[model samples]
Target: MNAEGLRERWATLTRCVCDGARLMVGQGNYDTYVAHIRKTHPDQQPMTPTEFFRERQNARFGVGGRGGFRCC
Candidate 1:
């Protein structure tokens, strides 16, 4: 591959690795979240990165008494 193409591939691979690590640690991928929201929920506003992080933490730990047993 050309230099630019190799650089792009390396960047993509690095991003995927970082995203996976974040997921393993219970941190959501903000960019992916925004992309999905724009594609699937175009009329709704996407959350700021801080809001998204808080939401993910709440969902993972069931905080704020919003609901119990989210999986159910």
Candidate 2:
């Protein structure tokens, strides 16, 4: 492969690794979400980064100000 192709592959690999690490730590990958939304729901709007983060946090944890995991 050419230098450019090798660099692209390296970059893609690096992004995947970083994304996986973020997931492991309970963080969201906004770019990936946006890409998926754009590809699958072109007519819909994507959330802003802050909104996306909040949405993800609420989905993972509990929504109310109560606390962490909810069992109801």
Name model 2 segments beyond 4 Å from true.
1-10, 64-72
- Which regions of candidate 1 are displaced past 4 Å? 65-72
Clash pairs of candidate 1? none
Candidate 2 Cα RMSD after full superposition onto the native fold (Å): 3.9
Q: Write the residue-wise lDDT of candidate 2 on 1-72 in tens digits.
A: 899999999999999999998787566799989999999999999999999988777866767663656768
lDDT of 1 by residue, 1-72 (tens): 899999999999999999999988678899999999999999999999999998988877668886633665
Instruction: Please list the Cα RMSD from the true structure of every candidate, rounded to 1 decimal place.
Output: 4.0, 3.9
Superposed Cα deviation of residue 35, candidate 2 (Å)? 1.3
Model 2 residue 12 distance off true place after TM-score fit, in angstroms: 3.2
> lDDT of all predictions, in order shown?
0.88, 0.85
